[model samples]
Target chain A: MEISDTELMLLGLVAEMPRHGYELEQVIVHRAMREWTAIGFSSIYFLLGKLQKRGLIRAYTSRASNRTKAQIPGADSQISDQESEPNTKPRKVFTVSKKGMRILKNQALRSLREISAHYSSLTRGLLQWPFLSREEALAALQDRLEALRSEEDRLSGLQLDQQPLPDYENAMYDFALSQIESEYEWVKRTAEYMETKPWN
Target chain B: MEISDTELMLLGLVAEMPRHGYELEQVIVHRAMREWTAIGFSSIYFLLGKLQKRGLIRAYTSRASNRTKAQIPGADSQISDQESEPNTKPRKVFTVSKKGMRILKNQALRSLREISAHYSSLTRGLLQWPFLSREEALAALQDRLEALRSEEDRLSGLQLDQQPLPDYENAMYDFALSQIESEYEWVKRTAEYMETKPWN
Candidate 1:
């Protein structure tokens, strides 16, 4: 039940106040500094759907704008009619549940811990690189690869049974998997190359 | 002119021996550990196209097995099969051009520098966080936000006019942008919250 960055943002928004999908989209664009932030319109809906499915958010139907179409003579009917009419679909309002609040707190704490761990691990790895032999480097890479592969397997298994995620969430997961796989491959190739060549 | 990680690998493979698209793909998969490396099929073609366009790679019709049709059943079945399927769609045979090789060397150096810079920057940012007063933190966050926005503008402008990029290269650019934007938004919100809270 690990929340992604998108989920974290969605929850944080809801925690501030109850909001529907469009409103949430507007808030994210206006308040989140759109010059830097680039959440697409579809991504907002995707995140809102995920939050609701996870039971972190509750959605309720709200009255939305409805405009009647009027027939106009000598006009491109299809284009003009569609433009004049307003969307009539019921808007879904979302509020953060108690479970959502707990998840947010847990995620924040986890992020702080991860940031510290990443910093220390990166520092140690850099410092040790010059002193280590090729074999040691290979071994270190293998250990990291194994851990990443395990995480990939875990996420893959989830994909098989879990409901299809929204495009953005799926994209995020794919990106993470690709990054881990890329690193693992690079390490393996370097190791093989090093083994064959005369060690400098 | 810029070589991404996947492009670099492709260049390395070509440096070893001249290869066509299918052969290069296989080499990437088997010899280079591409599955672990996270290089996708689309990325191979994309890089090949770019390299050829840049005159860094050459194409030749080889008597290679074109299994593409066999892989896809009868989408265009009217045409009779021939005994020798000359890879007429220009099976790209890549060789490391002098310019390409020079670029690759520079890229390796740049990558190493970037890794060190990233580690130092992350460390500096995190350490500085604990030392800053509320006002200072808010100012710092604003500066970062502005910088990120400028970066996003550059990326978007680059994307709009440039030729299509390989999947891995595109992914790297996108992932970097997303990471910075998320952090920028988070810092801005956190700064606002801190401004309201009473410091003990």
Candidate 2:
């Protein structure tokens, strides 16, 4: 089961406790604010529904509220007689199932392992002494420049029928292309600097 | 438009020329293998439909091939009548619109700017000297360790519960928590090392 980041966070929350939808939403919004995990209330309901359908979670109604309602004569009288029928306004309590927990654990392990490996690789690459020949460095830089050129050309001819695009969408695309162009420029400057260096 | 990486690649391909769904899928899979933008054939059709709905692309049908029913004269007459209704299989031809081009440009520029900013920030941070005092560092490390201990306690109790959890999901949470613990240990060690080092 390929779960999104939001689903992963949802599973973590449920593992903490069997919480109602509203309560879960509050925990995600207020408690996990620093973690940068922002989930809308509607999305919590949506994910809960999806998780239930997948059998990763099970929902049941708590009896404490029912006991409170029973104290009022009208509340007891108005209660539906059908036990099998789901209550329309009942607060649903959710708990993660065995399957859900297994998935969560595996995903967590994989992510951690991946992060460790990436950090190790980055450290090794950054700290390694100069090993590549000048020819090799020049070749790599040239290849990167060629790739950038192709991307630039592809972006340049993107206009259709000579008409300007709408304001917002156009701005976004232009911004991205400009960023790519700027990176290309940086690469070019770096290559020039390398050429002038005594080591080269 | 905030298109995903896959969507951007698909749009770029379609922007080049009008092609049928199958052709577009083939182009992405075989020719652009090194680009690491592979998408399923169904995803191609789905994206095409979405693009059409969004008015980013328009589809047109190609002309049908000519064929005869049989060499028989009566069969030919029947075929001609059928041809009047146009026995043409619709081949969807996609073309990028002005809106799509604008969106592509904006996305490209934004990606460039964001990447540049990120690299610059990373370089700046790594090159800068540590500003935190020894006391502050020690306090932060202690707080982090305490938080990790609390988390470990919570996880330990969860392990004693009767209900089993999915391995992957549990592992994911465990790994994330473990990373926090590891970072806390690293910080403590680094602070100790800093204290023991002689001043220049």
Candidate 3:
């Protein structure tokens, strides 16, 4: 299937639990989906509709503003305005159909089995090192190092804003930060090498 | 200018040295360009035409089997049949025009400035942990771990095939292998976590 990364992520989320749009938005934010993709809070419903149209997910209705009553696992992390509002109308909730689970497995396997380092631009720049003077290459690596350090700082601040998260919720952030740290270390080592070695 | 990564890399190479289509293919292979991008032996001429259409590159004619006469660097790496066979037809040589150089630097800056961790499927898989039972998740992670180990083996074999390479020439393979190692470590850790933790 030609499912987008956003669509695939949404399918996985809906497969995990039948959630209303607003609740899905809360889970998306809770999982920090925005860090990797361009998925926005506003697009959740649209994606859900698309998923349902494709027969990958089915939509049902449920009473509103009562996620706690539904016994959502990460109740503390749910942050939808509608989830707390008083006496709202029933909302459309989504669950993964059998076809959805089937495709999710197929798609997830396609994703997981294909371990490509999709960070192309960095490798592009690295391969073109010969184009840069020694000083320029050094400067470029330094610039990258600065960007990574600030990115780390930005992520750490994000964690601070969501204090007392569940272990799984925290694992999502940890994976992102760990990835950043790995790149940061690699760039630092590269810069060090650039400084010592002479490339003209 | 929304140039694809192939166009950008082509721009960089042409800007570095004026080369015929055959000579460009040799340099691309020597640099292990195929490892990242899908520029095939046949497409170099097509890309050259595209570059010339945009006035980023200019074409000139040079007799075949005369690259040494052109003082080509890394002459030993040139593998194109036309470049070696005697008395072949004149071939089209590409040189980066001034406009090409300007655009190349601009595009390179754009490429280097952006950094995204493109490993989505693994993260997608992790966030959907609740969709699967503890056993299923464990099985999936184990399967991923197996794929990663085989990937490492495959990359190591690639490096071995190109023996006695220059340090700069070998950097491409090293970068690829290091990326595999990072993912291997990450998947291994994730599998271990899956093993110890129970998710319902």
Per-candidate Cα RMSD to the true structure, in Å, reads 19.3, 20.3, 8.2
State the lDDT of candidate 3 residue by residue for B77-150, as single tens digits: 44544555663467788899988887777666655556655555676666555555566666776777777788
Query: Which candidate ranks first by lDDT, i.e. highest?
Result: 3
Q: lDDT per residue, candidate 1, A1-200, as tens digits? A: 88765567667778778888777778765542222223568888888888889999898875544323333456776776577554546667789898987776555444332321111122223222333456655555566556657857865665444446533234334434554455446545545654676644
Tens-digit lDDT string for candidate 1 (B1-200): 56666676676667667777778777655432341234688778888788767876666654344555534565553342343245434454667777766665555434322321112122223222332345544555466556657757865666444447543334334444454455456555555665676641
Ranking by lDDT: 3, 1, 2
Place model 3 in a CAPRI quality band.
acceptable
Q: What is the interface RMSD of each candidate, in Å?
A: 14.4, 17.2, 2.6
Across B84-173, the per-residue lDDT of candidate 2 in tens digits comes to: 444345566788888886665554434322321111111111111132244543444455456556756665555435136433223323
- How accurately is candidate 2 docked according to DockQ? 0.02
Report clashes for each candidate as comma-separated counts: 1, 39, 0
Look at candidate 3 and tell me the lDDT of residue A200.
36
lDDT of 1 at A12: 70
Docking class of 1: incorrect
Which candidate leads the pack in DockQ?
3
Q: Please provide, for model 3 over A1-200, each residue's C-alpha lDDT reduced to its tens digit, 9 standing for 90 to 100.
A: 66877888888878778877887788777756677566877788888899999999998877755654446664544454355665346778899999999888767656655554454566776666665566665677677777778888988888778888665556667767776777777767767866877663
**lDDT winner, 1 or 2:** 1
